[model samples]
Target: MGVFTAADEERQRGVRRMKTIATGALALMATVFVLAKWAQSAGAGSWTGYVAAAAEAGMVGALADWFAVTALFRHPMGLPIPHTAIIPTKKDQLGRSLGDFVGENFLSGEVVRSRLSAVGIGSRLGAWLAEPDHAERVTAELATALRGALAVLRDSDVQAVVGEAITRRADAQEIAPGLGTMLEKVVADGGHRRIVDLVCVRAAEWLEVHSDSVMDAVTGGAPGWTPRFVDRKVGERVYRELLRFVTEMRDMPDHPARGAVDRFLSDFAHDLQTGQETRERVERLKREVLGRGEVQDLIASAWNAVRTMIVAAAEDERSELRVRARAALLSLGARMAADGRLQGKVDGWVEGAAVYVVTTYRDEITSLITETVAGWDAEHTSKKIEAHIGRDLQFIRINGTVVGSLAGLAIYTVARFFGV
Candidate 1:
């Protein structure tokens, strides 16, 4: 059988047992009354008459209670008795009342606060989080959640956001002053000397490789009427001077030509950072560079590479990102377990968050209970409730029967003592 069906059958058996006990109690009381009355009619002792009276009263009380309880659940003996079968007949109204009762009493803001405070939620959270294993579990779950969120974001959406951000930033800020200031610092710190050296070396190598071309260019610039020999001689002299100048720049760190070039660059750097005309020129150059299609393509390519790397990292189990995430989790767990101050801080955070939610959305949350109850089929709701609580209520009937009988006997004895 299904689980629910088995539970229902169990509930039904309980209900039947309760009814049987109640009926049996009433029948026994009635039997006592009948026996007592017979003894009184046969001229038995006054004690027998008193006993009959008490039993008779007890029987009435028991029967009355039985009828009252039976009427709540069903019509007695299947007869159309007024006000009987109260639950089945007025189930809808009962459901609404129950819903309203729960909403007002159990779901109210004050009730929730009182209940939570009584439970010592903050301390409980602190105690739970103080465990290393619990903290590690929480951290792992958080990492998984972050990974899922990252995975859900589309590449196109990210690319658009990145592109717009870059464009906006570029449009809002002047890049030249920043660039110039950085260059000025690099120059002052001798950071640019290595670059200068590299340039000199490359130039010397190029001149050595293209000596013939250099000679041709120098001679070609000469007048057409000049003798070929004279042109060749002049070209050779010019080529040799150019090659010697490059070789000196490359080999001699303190060459006069090198010092002049360095001084010129230092002055230019200062002007780029501070001079108005120089700044304006730098700004113009920046605008021109940023306006180029190549610059835009480079920015887009950077975003693409970053996005691809992130996606790959998110997908890979052995990724540095994931490894760091796991290690962070374990470390957090260790800290939470060892440090009481940290545990308290975490607990406070949790309490604050929970209190905020309860204060802000309490009304809506409470209303859900009422709304759910109102939406339920009343008969089904009543049955469900009865299934849970009816067995317990049966005990009330049993106690009443036993107590009423004892009380009746005591009253009868008191009345006899008073000679009533």
Candidate 2:
């Protein structure tokens, strides 16, 4: 006997019940036979013979079905008949067939697509994600995933990738035209005015601090043949004129010097955009900048700084970046819940994405079913299947027995009426 757990005990009880019913059927047929034999010995009518024949046929039918059903699970009466113990003997083939059947019927693309469509995946997903807690959960999960990915990447690898990308981008695209266009826009919009103002302010402060340097440059640049006093006077005049010019330029927004500066910028922009010589010079400058070890170091350092900052922000719950991300997620959820138009747009996007996946990779997805079935150990698979579905199959034998008896009785009655 096998080990008897509660489930095994229950299955045993069911088997016993089936056996009892079959046994009772055989006993009933046997009792009918004994009654017919007794009646015949007691000088009963021909009806007794017909009843005996029907009961005998019914008994045969019941026994045959019992044997067929019992043969599946074990040997009938311990006899080694051909095709007996079918489940154990042919379990592997049955499993393969089952696997094939499931692959063909259940895992087909049409079935999957139809089922997904019937489920209203997009609307359901949108409704679920529209909840604030759900959105927050998703955001947290995304953050964790990003953190894990960043942690797994080596810094040297990332630095190399960044450096290569920057070099490739610089090599592929000419920068002068774009820069010139941008510069032209800045100058036209007076966006460079603040920069110019800042420069003027800094220059005035520097001049105030370095008055002795200015006086010395003035004196040194003076002619040697002139008298010392006259040279000093001339230097004083030059210093005063320079100071006055600087003050006027700083105070007067529409000074001629400011106009000259703007005109110079405009011409430079035009030359950068249109002049071949200017573009060649710009290219040379770009090459020089890219060739520098300091530039490469800066590029590598930027990657390191970004990687460190992201890892730190991801690790810290109190970090502003994470807090802002969570708040943004919650706000989006609130909006999605409240706004039908936004929800509809989101649903449309989701549906489109799902459809695209199904259409593009439906074959690969369906092949997973076929491949997985093809890989299973067939005998184990069969046993597992039988464990789940065997109880229901027992009913087939019960129905056959009951139906066979009714047919047998009907045939007997018809034969009696025909006087057979």
Q: What is the lDDT for 60 in model 2?
A: 72
Estimated TM-score for each candidate: 0.70, 0.65
Model 2, which residues run further than 4 Å from truth?
Answer: 1-63, 66-118, 121-163, 211-259, 291-367, 398-420
Minimum summed lDDT over a 10-residue window in model 1 is located at 121-130
Estimate the Cα RMSD of every predicted model relative to the unseen true structure. Answer: 5.5, 6.4
User: Which regions of candidate 1 deviate over 4 angstroms?
Assistant: 1-13, 27-136, 207-242, 256-348
Model 1 has a clash total of 0
| lDDT of model 2, residue 171 | 80
Candidate 2 local distance difference test against the native: 0.74
